[model samples]
Target: MQTNVYNIAFAESTKQVYLHFWGCNIKCKGCVCQKVVYDFMLDRNMHLHLAEPRGLAAAPERFMAFNDVIDTLVGLEAKWVLFEGQEASLDPQMPFIAEALHRHLGTTNVLLTNAFVMPDLRHFDKVAVGLKAFNENLHREYTGESNRTILENFPRIFHSGVPMMAETVLIPGYIDYQEIEQIAKFIASVDKNIRYQIDAYFKAGNNPWRRPTADEVDRAVEAASKHLNNVYAYKGSEPREFGVKSIFPTEAELDAAELAPAVESRHLVYA
Candidate 1:
């Protein structure tokens, strides 16, 4: 049970986990995955490509034997393992990694994939696919390709009996009601039970998308509400921003007192 070294997704509030593998097919234009790009550039001994592929560099650095990885998970007593990545299904070793982790953690396994590769769910406990931008052309424009595979794999995996969810980057103008509706339709086709999430893309540091507005987010959520039973908007601050307390709840605790429920405030605009 060998495992590949990867950056753990250290969300301020979430479950204990590790991003198992590396490399991605999509070089999203405004990617938050810049670390992988930098790592790939360093690993391949290549320079930065801020061009079409944007920050997508390939550095397939693997580490930690499978057994060792399992031992570590057991040692940490991590009840759950999340196989996360730009598109984890693209990693061939995913099934093996999942199997090994399943045996040890016996925890719910969640995969965050763009669905670049059709996954073999024989080992997965839960799967989350990025529906990305709602608009087909818009999605391709940002992520470098159309989400045909992700779209195609929807019902296939849903019917496979794994707990699944569909998510999107709520980029207004990029992801409008039409787009959200399309995403909802796709998820409903798979399983009406699958949850949906809209991650608000705000400017991070000096990153270009740092200040995406809340109106657009509202539109996306409004649209998705028609189709998805559950939806959460990421990046919007709780209480202060008037967002749901459980909007982006911590993995360990569903109800953390610090993150109070929002009061439904005004949509924020980026400067």
Candidate 2:
């Protein structure tokens, strides 16, 4: 009776395989994968919601059994099966899911999450905690929830003795120079077992906002440099990697047209 919510991915960039869980604890507003969980609003036009899995389509089934999910991975015969995406800890399913995949495939499990909910430490090998922002207001404004939950849970999340990769997405104007400085110092104050990741934002996905200037991203990076070690920006996404897809007509695209973005139009159709 394990949850059948996670997926196996083969990344073209790194030739790496990933096992990501669906659903999330915090709703980083305008998120792309709207079909996956309840934290954010869904955009049906851009992303589809199917009743079952068929190829790369997003499946509607929220829970995936570990044994059956493992069968998918072993069949693919991938090198490293990373436990990634959405938020892996929304249910007790992850620890058991991780255990099943690791025991059978003997592949590495890497988690990329907001750290709002920490999994049992004994489950995985490596962890990547999306350390959203150092300040509470900015974090909530950007991701739609206070940083308090994450701040409280992060310490115990690392009890696994596994190295953690700390990530921070630098959105335009949201994460200012002062905030970046605070973020760096905060990361440094926490156990130094973490690596700092500064990622950039774009008009795509579920992200809705103005694009920050290149200079601003640079300044934030500079401010962060003073407080911690090993900082790097998440390279911007390609304009439209066809297979990469879009959730809604991007904000810029929405403004450019006199018409409604697909989300509104589609809702009108079925309403």
Candidate 3:
């Protein structure tokens, strides 16, 4: 089966390579990736603003073949491979990708997902479920999709007996300390010892939420630690100064590169 891979990059902080696939089911209001991907596909000038709703009709460049991606990861001596996406589970060959990363490269495969659809957990070495918000109303508001399926899939993932971790972006008022605490409590229900990483939300696109201050991150972690045993928070940049490469253009590259020529049609667009 063919995989619709759009980009591949390595994260120095985790020493893991990321395989960026093309689609996502949920459209989070504050998503940074949507802006970046749309800019790469539509706005040739590489403006940081959102593409015209219609301009999203342009097809993304298929940067590399699946096997090429595998070969690249192996050459990098990558021990860990992350399946990232607008939603990785949406990829038809997702399980195959995880299996390939493990069977062919001996890499620890981790899927970073919203967990709306629970796949065979046995295919992965680790799973990081992004619990956007525990409150259903807030969840729907933030992600533009109901959290029912996601919440239901949580136990299924936990019971699969695969190693699991939870992550939630700490958007000051919307996804605040109380929200993290509530999310931590829910995770603690499944496993008190599961590591809960409360990440400070970064300002992306036109998101109105402010980036969390160091003290805010500390408070959120402290509050979450009340229920979760392994509570951690990351407030600063990942050691991105260490060289990391991507098949797609970064913000800087987009600004420097000439705008792409107009296209007549596209098979898909960000709906």
> Which candidate tops TM-score?
3
Number of clashes recorded per candidate:
8, 8, 0
| Cα shift from native, residue 13, model 3 (Å) | 10
Per-residue lDDT tens digits of candidate 3, residues 1-271? 4676776776555566777777788888777563355332222322333233323333356555667777777777778887786777887777776777788778888888889888766678889999999999999988898899998898789888888999999999889999999999999888899989988776554556777888899999999999989999877443324445553435455443324454456323232
RMSD of each: 11.7, 8.5, 5.3
CA shift of 51, model 1, Å = 22
Number of backbone clashes in candidate 2? 8
Residue clash pairs of candidate 2: 3-64, 4-63, 4-64, 4-65, 5-64, 19-82, 30-206, 199-234
**Top candidate by lDDT:** 3
Give residue 8's error in model 1 in angstroms.
3.9
Q: Write the per-residue lDDT of candidate 1 for residues 1-271, one digit (tens) a residue.
A: 4545353332222345655465678867655454332121121212222222222223334355655656655655665667765566766677777787777667677887877778878888888888776566887888788877767777787878888887776655555557777888778766666888887654322234433467767777777778777876764443321111111112223223214443345111110
10 residues in a row with least lDDT, candidate 2 = 48-57
Candidate 2 deviant stretches above 4 angstroms? 2-7, 12-15, 34-63, 204-208, 237-271
Residues 228-252, model 2: lDDT tens digits: 7777665443232322211122334
TM-score of each: 0.70, 0.71, 0.81
TM-score of 2: 0.71
Over 4 Å off in model 1, which ranges?
A: 1-3, 9-15, 35-62, 204-210, 239-271
Candidate 3: clashing pairs of residues: none
In model 3, which regions exceed 4 Å deviation?
11-15, 38-59, 237-241, 247-271
